[model samples]
Target: MHIRVYNTTNAFTSLGATFDERVLLGRGPTSSTIHGELRHRVGSLLPQQGNDASYAQLYIYDPASALEVRNCRNQQLRRDVLQTIQDTLLQVNPFVEKFR
Candidate 1:
């Protein structure tokens, strides 16, 4: 998965001494098959920097599934991915709130 930062507020920056304006969420070479496939399909998730705000978006690729799936298998994968994202956000909510 990859999370492209959309914006960060001054309040957020004040909490940290150093901040990366952009962040990559997963640890894999961009040349890897899955990454390549996602890049091809979704284009770029990272917006031009300086568009400061407070939100991020996750973009993931499953080469075996269509972007919009009509079948059971792909639907299951979508559900699982959604669940994972929700769980992750719940786990991170407190840490995120700390910057506020």
Candidate 2:
């Protein structure tokens, strides 16, 4: 699936730029167990501030993949990643704005 967030934070944008695709392999509390594989993409407008955006693409085996993300076996890491995605999305969220 796909998601687009606008007016994201700097940290979010930075994290997005460096976000690792391996996170999709979320192994839960299993410590780097990696359940599956996925990808992500966070972008920005050509203009300036207030026009930044972010996006995340996931490739789960099935809808059940939620099980890995939702009730993750690893609580801390899962919480950290989830929180980062949430907080950042709100910060420098990506969108379809035209930069000048």
List per-prediction Cα lDDT, in the order shown.
0.31, 0.33
Task: Give the winner by lDDT.
Answer: 2
lDDT tens readout by residue for model 2, 5-90: 21221122323233345655656543222334543334432324653122221111122342243324334344445555544543
**lDDT for 100 (candidate 2):** 9
| Candidate 1 lDDT over residue span 19-67, tens digit each | 3323444665543223222211222334357631222212122312322
Which whole-number lDDT from 0 to 100 does residue 41 have in model 2? 37
TM-score, predicted candidate 1 vs. hidden true structure: 0.20
Model 2 scores worst on lDDT over the 10 consecutive residues at 1-10
Return the lDDT, model 1, position 82: 41
Off by over 4 Å in 2: 1-55, 58-81, 95-100
| Model 2 deviation from native, Cα RMSD in Å | 14.8
- Candidate 1 stretches greater than 4 Å from native: 1-77
- Residue 77 in candidate 2 has what lDDT? 45
